[model samples]
Target: MLSTPNKQFSIEVTSDSTTVAPPLLSTTTKKLFIPPWKVPETKAPMVFPTCPPSCNKEMSRFNLDGSLKDLGSYGFWVEMCGKLFLFGRRFVNWEQNVEECCKIGMTPIDLELATDVKCINSLIGDDDYRNRFSRYYWTFGLRKTEEVVSSYYWCSSGANITRNWGSGGEPNYVKNASENCVRMEFGRATNMLYLLDSNCGLVSGLSCQGPIIPKTCDSPVCPVYTCRKRDALFKTLADKATKVLIDPSKSGIWVTNDTRLFMISYPSDTKTFVESLAACCAVGLKLLSLHQEVMYSILVGAFNNASIRGEKFWTAATDQGCKKNFGFCSTNRLVRDNARWASEQPDLSTSNGTCLAVSSDGLLHDELCNTKMRYVCEGRAQIPSLLDAVERECAAEFKLTRSEVKALFNSTPDELREKCFLKCYGEGTGLFIDGNLAMDSIFAAFQRITFDDTKRLLDMYSAMDYCTNSSKGMDECDKCGSLLNCGQENSPEEFEEFVETVQLTITESPLILPPVKGVCPEYECIKKPDQVKLLATAKNFTRFIGQAVVLPFVLQLTVVCNKKFYVFATNVERTLSRNLAFCCDRGYRMATIDTKEKYDCMVQNRITTFLNLPPGTTFAVGATRLGKLDRPSWCYSDTEFDFNLAEDFVSNDTLETNYGIAISFEPPLIMKAYETSLHVVCEK
Candidate 1:
């Protein structure tokens, strides 16, 4: 095997003369000498020949033995400046191609400019190859070495070309940096050359350096280009849509199962709720429901470019006409199917004024009764008969009258009284009675009596009377000094018994009366003595009339006597011959005896005695007595006490008798003493 650079040839020397070399002259001898043939280094840098004067006009000519060979049609050639030139077109490894071109005294093609691209296209003589050459191609200016060295060296002019490294580059070996072989589009650096292992033997196009000949060319319509630009547009749109659709964080576009027709941003006036819902419906999407997932989806885009009231978005759920059923409705299936039944039987009475909208926080919310919001209208579903029946049953069971309810609850035990009160009256019950006299009275009465008695009494009174009477009775009970009956009648004995009861009970009850005038007379006189009466009489007095002026006329009287004083009667048949004699002592004087009046007017003319009498005083015998007295009589008997005048006559004999018989007469000494006392008192 003969390893030749750029060519693989096998030689067999069978004769002795082929094996034996011919004599060769030394370089120092002057005689003519021929150099021995030897293989050149395969990994060496490529050497290019000097250009002739007609180099741009014609192909370079080269001889077979390291000399310029003449251009020929049968030999491999390349074009130059639109002229046909002989150049190899057979496949060869990149290293061999570079050596072969160097042996033929030409440089491998290195494409850099547009003209260079055209030149390579012409040289390839195949459309596909020319197209690829214009885009990317390798050259012998770079080579491979040990350690997979990838480096290249300029061949045509020995200039270091370091631009346009495609993908794989960088030398692995020192020699590979000078190696005359390279692969195109395989480098770490773009627009540059790199080294590779010589054993790789990958084929590539050659590169050449020269002033490029211009060519008339048509504008490209389908120039080869990467699809990255178109791909980038698709990728951007997809990324945006995904963010909007599945954002757990709300910074970006929000989405829902149903598309929100418009994004209402603050500062941008948009359509009303109804109008927005209509717009969404035009595109075949409904407003979101209470389903959190679906609601989240629908409200995704809603907050994108709009101002919202709160975070919540408005849904089709409503409680306006649903006061009777104000709670979450179990219509999950309907909601999933985009259908909703009207709550409370669809009374559209105020439908025109209601609206729905989304809040800033992306939750569904409602606006004011008359506000215009972006509403999500929904289609109605039929109410299930079973649910309706259940509701009716509940309504029926809950019906109750106020009294029945009160009785049912009030019957509870004392332990439950507080709870029952709260249930019946709501909150504390003390305020119900505060400052209300009638209520307080009723409560007070209840405390005083048993519940049964209170109920009976309350029933007996009319509503108006109950209130007025209760208030009045409360007032009386507060002040009255008698036992209160609370408007209930008691037996006479029981009434008496109650009176004997303590004053506190009397004050608390309502039956007692207020104070008034008048007394029970049957018991008044027995306890009082200043009101007794008396009478005045004279002897033989059938008719009597007298007038006396008395000062201090309001004197109270009291009389005590044992016997009745008498007034005598006159005899009509005969008049007594004797005249009634009247007598007066020295201080007692009888003024006149009047037969018509039948009494002597006796006046005590004693000054001290008369002056000593109190004003309005009168002296009389018993008209009514302290013990007991009968009609007036003259005979005072049966242990009677009396005052009467006595008369007597007396005689006395003188003691000196002898001288003359003299005689003397005297009244009785007691009577004489009376007469003498009366005369002596009168003289004083």
Candidate 2:
């Protein structure tokens, strides 16, 4: 396999038998770069309407028609290379230029026009005119707040402005002067465009940009391809062997009877977690989710079969919220019973972030989300004939002729065509009900097209449903795309979830039409070592430092309190300080009992049996009358505990008492001295 020098992508070899080689001789670099500024002739200026009373700028600011409200109200409003732009004649502050553009129903020039500085500059015939208008101009790049430090966004599109800043290292905010707005300036020395963060109050010429005019078909009549024509075309294409199909076994990819196709990636072509997620989605799959032990074992066996062991492979288990609660991204539910953490794991240290990866031992370990790692992909293997039949029928219904539809699939689809195709497929597959995704129908469709195991189909439907539901209010086409996006892409949090640009792999792999019978490799489950529960003393506890932010821990507890679990380290003896340290060592917060409901629950239940403690023994809890308060408050985590339920306490308070207690078979919470030894209860 050959990868780019930057490792952004690699050539995918379908079969292990195939080999790829670099060119025997290096080719000459092509120097056919065309400068946008080299235009044949300058376009005529726009004619504007008369200026209104509200306008206070000079007469020259208005167009030749003597009006600022007209089309060319700014400088020279012209369409260049199919995009609309306005070059202003007068100097105006960033805010004023924004208002002026809004007055004309446009936004400040965006990155596209800003990059082609010479094109706009060349439009001016005279050097003086170019220096006056195109030399420097305000753009839509604006940083609204100082809190964000140094990121500017297009005010109109909200896209991050990431052009080559050139040598000046501009977005420096000019020695912290609060230069929160961006303007484009031409470097006379380099003849290149530079995006500089400038003060909003600075005056500069206006440069506004408008949307591109879409290409229109000249013929108004669109010839419809009826079902008869579609079938005939399909027969022709089938006879010619035009459609490329995937056969898993021949391609060295694994498929299981459980309705999941597992695509194993190798170390040579590793990608960051987010990029891996997108890579899988690009081909209609998701990062493998190990939520089920049986699935995990089967995948591990596949790893052994592929000779891809002894390395870390990224899984869908991640705390996408950045919270410590790790869950499978495919399902937003917490990873509780199935979480197999390595020793001292999920420490949330800078090195070990909130993302998860499975080692060769089949145990989950925390890894940075940005770290490059091999990943496994999981999805239902498609039957090529079924997919082709559906695609042909939809293309006919949408009037996307047989050739056009085939070409669209062969290449990367444009926005309009892709959306139209998605709409056709969504409806054709019965996945949509009244223009909305009907999640239940997904299972029915899966059962009809793929394997017919009820349990496996249900699991597949559940994952797809979660992803689709999260994108409910999006456009129909976007929703369809999002269903394919699944994991990190459709997560609730706003994140840099996708790669900056998607590179389309154009070369087609060899095709095999026949269905590959999937076989799961036999795997024997090995018993793993039990986690050692260690006792924490005041001296030894300080060795473990807390995370930068103390996120709520995910607890695995045996006792349930009001549907929430409270874990007790029964193996470790407890002292007021030792108990607190023990919970901290385990990344848990000591149990807090400030609410009346908690007090009542403990009072009603047999506390000794529930906690596996001796009867009449007093256990330590996370409560204290901090700083001369009349009643103690629960203050283990950053969360504030309610003290209004002080009246519900057993009227137990004393000057010597500094710690809270839960007595076995006792109803109300009582206080104990700092040195007091008692059983401890901890919560996440």
Candidate 3:
């Protein structure tokens, strides 16, 4: 076994110092002049010091020799003081096995020389002590070579010996043969040891060399000062970093420290599933799979920087290019409000301008490529929020007011109101009235009013008329007849006689009735003015009267009348005059006669017969008669009467007397009596 060496020293004798020992010469019986002390030969083997007791325990536990008793079933072993000790039964590769030993406070053995191998072999004993000896096995120490050499060297044993042959033989690292890994082998040539290459990941035994140490792996490595230093460095580095720098042009796998996160920015705004995956690979970040924790870690890493612009970012998870795997994709973090899954087998022929993001909350969110954001990257999936986690967000996005809530009961329509409502509120909200939405308070109030009230209001300002009395029954007279029925008492014979005398005299000789000249002005009567006429005649003790009244009622009202008088011989004319005066007082105008031309000729002839005009006298009868006829006169004088009588005789030869001549000459007396009675009756 290798052992520690002792210190050695040497002594040299020189010529006797000047006269030194003279005092001691007496005993010179062959005592050579030598130094009082001589150096001794120290023989010690080249060995490291004995390891600490803790290290010795760890080394013993990981020993690989069969004599070493196993402590557990994991195939772990240790070596301490050149003795082998075992811990577990399971075999692991050299690197992994070494790591396991280290976890238990032991380190893999460094068998770089033959002495190390000999020392270990001696402690475990030789074949002489056992029924059969096990073949040498490969140790953790390995060699890397590009080609196979004629002689394979054992890094652990530090020799080219065949005693440690693998199951088949020693490895040949000859020229032109590349050897990149090392493996382990066990058993002898007869039994055949197992040989495994490093790259092949074959399982094998492991050994450790050190003091047997019992250490719990939970010991803290980073002191508080070291932690502060690391945190400061992280902050300083992060502050200066403007963007995550990844070289998409390079190709290789990469890993992130726990302090740093990995992210990938796609080269283009949009891409196919295949293209996106390729982009990720170019940046050394594999698209995530369905490992929840890893995915969550990746997302958290992405959002570590608070200065990220977009609230959400994307991840590479779409399986659009995958044929067999469907529904393998990332979900939107804001999906409760804006959730939508891509159409199955989205049309790749068209540009799908969508992008995926891994948000700071450790959730995946998708957005259009034009939207900018920060994102996270991971090797796998993560657990999403629980069902109730996003409820508030969803409610905020979809909440409705009372009016909108009521709309849930109505049917959709085709008009603008309905269309607008649908556009704003989506498909099925109920608030329609007659195909129009009662969306406003005013419109709702209007809809609630009764139809009758609406109609009345529409016609409120119209106007109409009402009748008090119809003109249908009002009396109307056709004409103004003679007003001759005034007297209540008159003999029928007298009345008859009066009427006959007036009619006969006026009809036969209107001129003899004495024309009432200027009764109305000629100019006034010429236009056939509407007139009323009155006739009065008297016989003894009786008077007759007839009157016609003309009433002209138009926009203005007027009345016209004519009155005439006729008398019997004594006092009758006077009685008639009284009646005429009464009629005149009742608004009557007298009728005029025009007989000047004919009557003037007759007057000249009568004058010639009665009395010749004096020799020089110019008898202008036409002038005189015209003058007399034009003047207003109630009665004719004697001369005017005689002339008028003679004129009448010459014109018609019928008027032979001015009055009833000598016939009934004695009637004057009776006539006078009748006239008196007539005057009295007329006066009454």
Residue 657, candidate 3: C-alpha displacement in angstroms? 99
State the lDDT of candidate 2 residue by residue for 255-364, as single tens digits.
44322357767557688777766655544456777654335555666677666657888887766534565666643234555457788887665523367888866778
The C-alpha lDDT values of all candidates are 0.26, 0.46, 0.28
Candidate with more favorable, higher TM-score: 1 or 2: 2
Models 1 onward score TM values of 0.17, 0.23, 0.18
**Which one wins by lDDT: 1 or 2?**
2
Task: Summing lDDT over every window of 10 consecutive residues in candidate 3, give the lowest-scoring window.
Answer: 461-470
* Candidate 1 per-residue C-alpha lDDT over 1-684 given as tens digits, one digit per residue, 9 for 90 to 100: 222232322122122222234354442432212212212244532332221111111123322332333322112234466433323322234544543444433444553334644554343443222212211233534442223444345443344546544324444455443333444432111222333323224333233322222322211111121211112212211112111112212211222211123322223224443344343333223434443222343344445544444443345443443332221121111122222323333334453233334455544333543444434322211111122222222222334444544453333212232222222221011111111222222222222222123233222222212223333323222311111222222223322322222111111000001101100000000100011111123222122322223211211111112111221111211110010010011111111111212111122211112123333222221111111111111110111221121121111211211111100011111111100011111000
Clash number by candidate, in order: 79, 3, 50
Best-to-worst order by lDDT is 2, 3, 1
The most accurate candidate by TM-score is 2
Give the top-scoring candidate (lDDT).
2
Better of 2 and 3 by TM-score: 2
- lDDT computed for candidate 3: 0.28
Q: Rank the candidates by TM-score, best first.
A: 2, 3, 1
Off by over 4 Å in 2: 1-259, 331-333, 350-353, 381-684
